[model samples]
Target: MSRTPDFLAQGHDERDPSPWLALYLDQSTPLPDEVKAAWLTDSSSGSRQYLLPFLRPVARLTIILIQVVKVFVPRNWSHSKLLHRLLAWGLKRFVSPEANWLILRHFHLGSQVLGFIGRNSPAPVGTSPLEPADIDALKDETFLKHDLNLFNFVIRLNQALRDKGLVLGKAPQVDFSMIRDPGLRLSDMPHGKLNFLDLQSAIELFTPLYQLMLTDNDFWRAANSLQLDETIGIYAATLLGAPEHLILVNNKHPLVPLSTLRAGHRLVIHGLSTEMLHSLLRRMQAAHGATPTPEQPLA
Candidate 1:
């Protein structure tokens, strides 16, 4: 491919070139600062769309039906805590072990990403970075120790619900050793590698973490792209299960799903892409004093 000077020009609209293409191009030659600014401005203008086009009609009809059904149902049916608890109880009765395992894995991945940030992020003048020996040690020391640890905390939470007559199936035991540390937002890992997450799993795992961190507007303001990407891969695993597909990054490829590019879609990762992973690997390798090689680069 031949490179052109104006292709990397300032004030270029990223969306015009399409996000996927823009990302790949931005890799070898970073876009001008003005181009990024303009791109972000344009991308951020859309409304949040949580449902698919087909689902929107179904959802509306379901809501209307619910309203109609409510007229005949007892008023207490909607507001009753006991009724809600009963529903939860029934739901748990159907919680398969596979479902429990999937939930545990996602939470475990989330915790690992958070722990990586806590350990590697710079500390304040009076403080030091958290340095846990391993996942267990990390679990014991982190704030999420009480609520986020899948084996201990989440298990306990499920037990508590069970104690209250909720029927949630037991959270499956997850092996934390399988979880890989996503080094930095800019770190890169080869797709064939063990730690790499494909598009679907990437989106599923990060969506909740993104919401959790961005819940507070102040924290959202403080967060950077690296934090977002690294936490999500914008965050995935080896032992539990592999991603459904090998993620690709072409706009016109029939194998690639266009719905992934839409905001709030199940596969949306905003701008998080392979570029972030590559940058992260380089940064982390340098931090650990490991020399990068083509055969074994990145974390």
Candidate 2:
């Protein structure tokens, strides 16, 4: 077989590829604004103007990198909408994964990963991180569709790993929750008056034994918060369809549900602290069928 592989050796006008190669290998080329324009075309509505803010930090440098050298350009090189993508792409292609383990030299991997899962930041793989506020501002369907993208990545990676004989059958860790909004009848679910139906509405959004939690007055008890939390918890447990022993559950921070507990419609709690649980039961005791008004400001 001839030494040069067919893939790399293409282009018949090979008057020595080396001299011609200087065109791309050169440094000091200028990065440009038009490149940004090329990328902005596809952004949703005014995403360009909104994304412009994050793009500024590395715009000039990225313009230079994108044009000047292959080593500098990110592997997924679409145009530079912002510096982060430039960094994400350049690092992924230029650096060897074998050497860097995801080329995470400058990033806090754990924090970024958490932000992706909870904050709804960072679409999987090549996508840029969205601002947390931006995420919340998104319509529920858009945000969740983005979230499922991340979930799919996890599932695929695990399948790849197992196929390679790496030997692990565990599905990725996940959490589920059912949270009651605070109010008369909203947050106040007495044992007898529980709205297992609406809870199912949320649960159906995420389902079937992945993991679960319930947030009650303990987490977001504005004051006189209702005690319908356990009712939600039991409801979630029933939805999980697991024997009690295998039902992974918790109620920490009651506000910020644990990271592992996400990927399901799990209740978000303010905290699972004793103060939270006590405050919840106290509200329950004070209830008189009519909901008590919440009085304390959140600490």
Candidate 3:
């Protein structure tokens, strides 16, 4: 027998293979002598042959269906009282004891064993971070999907703030020259950057203007305004359009519903303190029939 199995020799990262990989291995890779012997000993009462082909495509299909249901049904719907009752009835009537046993032992137990082995395995060394150019390229591709340019919006907002005679307590952390200059191309603008001060400045200027526009309030005549507050608000919520660094979900800030968070929706509460913001979030959640809990993740 070959000392190194094909599964082990596969050019996967030295770090643990995923749960899916483990399932694939369980089907393809031969079991160790100890494991087979243990299975034989455990199967004294029932014939071992009866439990043959435990890792079937049928089992995988069942698991996949469960995942699809979870994905299509929003979390709130799944947790609803009516759905809970239906789920209980469905599981009891539809799922058999033998099927349950197979799921518990063959699928769950095997996956747990694979997970343990993977966790204990050594990680690969010398993996470098993504290059700055690569990061910039990704950002540019992402930004192309949206209509507004975030950096330019920020620079325009700063000018609006100055015109309005609003003095920020601190100067913005982001340099606006690259974006403010019409001579520079989009590629020449700062890459993969998001300064909090710049973000706050954009929020400060854009949100109030947006809210006013939403209400159709009379402040539609400011001299230095770009007439693009709606555009700025739309892009600001996505702010960098990077999921890993989302700002709207921050616990300290108010959460905005993505569907309603676009350009024209009500997104601002002028002079709202941090405490007031959290209070408003709870009220909003309650009004929407979503139970508010401290541990619940921001939407």
Candidate 4:
């Protein structure tokens, strides 16, 4: 626990941790500077710049259509079982395995990030473990709405890693009995609703929409960048009492106003905030050895 675990460090180079651990662990430079650098670096390398001109109009139109549809259609329509099955069928039949791999890998990485924070922090920051029933429900929902094949692939991959004596972090664990808000489940949040339209869901939905416009690699990289933004919002929700702030619509840094910008301003800010809060929590725990009470249930 004193240093980054070996498994997480496997592919990472200590000298330059640009994409993954830099935002999480590095505290030497001002985070805003790091974020600017990370943003510019990602923007310079990816296919995003090439496709942006073509995709921007389509993306904008899609957003307009969604907004229009929201007026006529009931919000619950997003959760229609029939619609999910149709989408799932298309994804399974049409989505390339390579793209699916990238999609599923993001979830694994997100879980690792959460687990690391949980284990390293003094108090449980985001340790709401899904129950067995919840897990089953998620599997069923994912199979219907997301890519089940990719889910199974990752499951096998994780097992293979375990068989080889490699240990990757699993979801965070905490004693629910000792927590004040034990009922804090993702389903209770507005953005977490099965029927809600949010950035994470939008990114998944975009996979099918942009499949023709982008190569699998291009799509994955673009989607991963956006997901990183969502991940920052998630960190805010867990640590800062703001669950609905899980998208980048208005959270973009002020100095850079271009819609085409793909930096991690919000990501770096919230990430550093989470780390600082963890430090405070560690000190609190050291001084008192008592569980800090949960903030008032997120409204």
**lDDT per residue (tens digit) for residues 184-259 in model 2:** 1111111122211222122222221111111221112211111223322332233223224112223433334332
Global Cα lDDT for candidate 3:
0.27
lDDT head-to-head 2 vs 4, winner: 4
Give the better candidate number (3 or 4) by TM-score. 4
Instruction: Please report, in order, the local distance difference test score of every candidate based on alpha carbons.
Output: 0.31, 0.26, 0.27, 0.35
Question: After superposition, which runs of candidate 1 have C-alpha atoms over 4 Å from their true positions?
Answer: 1-57, 60-91, 95-99, 124-299
Pitting candidate 1 against candidate 4, the one with the higher lDDT is 4
Error of 4 at 292 (Å): 28
Candidate number with greatest TM-score: 4
Over 79-136, each residue of candidate 1 has an lDDT whose tens digit, in order, gives 2233224323322333222222222223334444333322222220111222333223
Quote each prediction's TM-score. Answer: 0.25, 0.19, 0.17, 0.33
- In model 1, state the lDDT of residue 296: 27
Model 4: per-residue Cα lDDT over 155-190, one tens digit each: 444465566665433224322112221222332222
**Model 4 residue 293 CA deviation in Å:** 30
Deviation (Å) of 248 in candidate 4:
16
Of the pair 2 and 3, which is ahead by TM-score? 2
lDDT of 4: 0.35
lDDT score for residue 249 of model 3: 24
